[model samples]
Target: MYPASYYYRRRLPGRSRGKGLIICLIVFLMFSTGIGLLKLINIQQAIPKFPLLILGQKGENALNLMCSAMPLLPVSIELNDESNNQSSIQLADILVLRLSRVFRLDRQSPIALLEKELPVPVEVESSAVPVMKAAPVLPNPPSPEPEEPRQAQVPTLSEECLMAVYNTHTGETYALTDGMDRLQGKKGGVVQAAAALEEELEKKLGIRVARSDAINDDVYQYSYAKSKAVLEKLLAENSQIVAAFDVHRDAGKSREESIVNIDGEILAPILIIVGSDARAEFPGWQNNYQFAKKLASEINKQYPGLCLGVMVKDGRYNQFLHPRALLLEIGSVSNSTEEAVQSARLLGKVLGPLIREIYENKQSE
Candidate 1:
């Protein structure tokens, strides 16, 4: 029933009035809040009362600053069990923000305040590790020498002081069990050793000699026993035979046997063993000692270190039979065959001269 223009103007005026009412009400509320806050300010008595809730990362202490500033606050740190996974909670002055430069809070018992400061206590365990050092290395040993070869022929027994030499064992005839009265397998090797020794002896003493078969018939005995028999036989037949010797081998395996190569010749370093059996009883292994020293000295002189050492043992070595009788071990079964054979050749070169000297000494006697 009203005109269209009048209705539009009337609606516009109503909207304006509504907007003005909303703006005036908002301004009044803001003004009232500001006056109330200003009236509540008591500068001297103002103290923050809000409880600070500080959550910290595991193993981290963010409340250290607060603890140092407010030593009397009696704050505490604990792990919160309410969390799905337990988390740490650190305490600080919560109302600190409400104060300006400085403020004082109520002093509380350290134990009680700390307990109320955190929801729960946090437990921590720590461990440390030690450093280690590396181990030291050992030094390597020097290598042994190789065997030497001789091309000289052996002297005939008649050409030397003795025509031929034979050996026997008093207690046990053979060198090993199931002994033979006459030399069997050892005959060739013995002859070879004797020939080598004879060659050297002939060169030094100008004597001719030869080695005969070793008797195997009898119970097996050590080489020393066999050496005694050879000495007795030499005394009975030649009467001038001196420097008798028994040759044998060692039982232990050594590096020299495997690697020693001299001028393409392989050999095991020799071990000159002397019996201490006499040394223990007589105190003067005079004969045996002299014998050992002579052998070691002569070998060292000729070969310049061929002899290992003169090791004294507890056995007589059968040297009691005759001062000239001796026992020698070339090498053990563990040694290469070449090393054993080479040792035999070397023994012959060394012994031949010593035997010739003994024969000459006996002739003078």
Candidate 2:
């Protein structure tokens, strides 16, 4: 009963209908495969790993220490790449570390042990390389007067600085009334961090630290007055108090910035803040810069990416009283108090050494 045309179409077994169906399937499969390959390539192009630029000797020093501890972080260290340019890293299993921060090996620890192990480029060629007999020998420049041996200077903490936490800001007294067990952050306060950083430094570095009144981040007028008062008191009391810090939290969303935690510990990401108050005389940043640079240099060495850069500002966050003060703005209010505390703890670890180095370097000079 089938039509004669249908019989004609089905010319041979596995020849007419079966062959057409097979051809159609092959075309469809090929199209799908092509699309999938393109999609995979696009995804690969989208998620390129971030390039870490470790600049300045301070930053480079910190990375050296970090690499010694954890060798798995994927970074392209451009210390001695032949290009001497911003080299592109091959996204391979190998870690990339770029040493833009130059270190005078003679100044820091031993060159043999540290330098030998690292991939850092060090110029060890002697300046006294013998010239050819035909070349004129330049006489050694007139010898300068011999320098005096210097002693390291230790910073003396002032009594006023010790009592800074006792002052009040917005009706809330700034004091570590309760030790670590009871210190907590108010809705818009950073007393706990100040207290914790101070306490640990005191115990670890044998240096005295004090906390200033908590000031609002938005209101400049009121905040400046309170900040100025604390600075004056510290400077008036302790000439050795080379640094003062104002710690604040940011107001950004949690997703925009977040603190990482491992088990019971919180991971901290500190942001350095510089003010922009143009009205004041002696923005006090130079002194602030000295302290900040010293701290940033040392901490960045101890903990890679832990101590962020020093922010330059035109305003006085009470930094005018002394050049050695800093304003630390940690992650925003959206983050939990625990995150801030975690950051404070990590900060303390490197802060002690940083302070020590600053004082030591000053004395050596």
Candidate 3:
């Protein structure tokens, strides 16, 4: 014979146990949702101060792109007006596109036409309103100056900039893809990333950066000495150059381990190396450390997890030459070239304004 409590439990059929589990699950879900919301809000920043470049890579399928950008779709935020589109993208009304089969319209293509008897021409009463003549067209106003004058001003604006970028380990390469081959020693894949950084700084950020394609590391051990010489020459040539970035790549990681994601886009993690005087005569190492920390913080503020962190090394990795010099590991050997290239653009986005601020301060002094 069973007890009365056992008979009561059998009658309910898990009703009491199910309710407790359901409540706990609901609480867990709510906590998870709250944390996710906080993370999204914390990642948002006011990027209106800089020229906004298209961060997405092309050639990606539409489905993945849509899914990646869905979380960042505008909920309550500010965007540029079409008339004042200083950045690359021009704001416009969103259009929903769908896949469907449609009739082809083209020239020089032969197709059988369906013949139909014409009915007649019917005149409409409101055909020509003639209201446009009453006032000048508000859209597309005449420019005060021609396109030539405006185009010429861009070079003049960026020519005054003093910045330098070069590759210490020019032989460093990354994972390859279709139609993209690896570079031989001397001009490796990392050089393209350095070139991209130089271009982004000049074109997007309006900062002219001198880049050297010299074969620095013909031999592995003397790479630092060769890079130091190159950096010295750059400093000598550009007297006003305040900052120098020596681009390199990290190693000893798998392809999947090397790449990091920020806002759904794949990126190569940036590691800032600040060398100290433990092995060499590096004075004012604290300055470089502080700068690196600030830069890492700024990059994380904009795209969290893209920057690994600032590292202090024992040997002087040619950073002893300049107070603002830094050695940047754009990615590891396992990352793709495209990932490094995109990361270079992101680095320029944060680094340009920081360097520009220092330049302005020096000028004011």
Which numbered prediction scores highest in TM-score against the true structure?
A: 3
| Candidate 3 TM-score, true structure as reference | 0.56
User: Candidate 3 — worst ten consecutive residues by lDDT sum?
Assistant: 92-101
Model 2 is weakest, by summed lDDT over 10 consecutive residues, at 91-100
Question: lDDT of model 1 at residue 170?
Answer: 20
Per-residue lDDT, model 1, residue 289, is 66
Q: How close is candidate 1 to the true structure, as a TM-score?
A: 0.43
Ranking by lDDT: 3, 2, 1
Using lDDT as the measure, name the better of candidate 2 and candidate 3.
3
For residues 230-295, write the lDDT of model 1, one tens digit per residue. Answer: 556656666555555655555545444433444466654566655555454534456766877887
| Global Cα lDDT for candidate 3 | 0.68
lDDT of model 1, residue 45: 24
The 0-to-1 C-alpha lDDT of every candidate, in the order given, reads 0.47, 0.50, 0.68
- Clash counts for all predictions: 20, 14, 0
How far residue 292's Cα lies from its native spot in candidate 3, in Å, is 0.5
Candidate 2 has a TM-score of 0.45
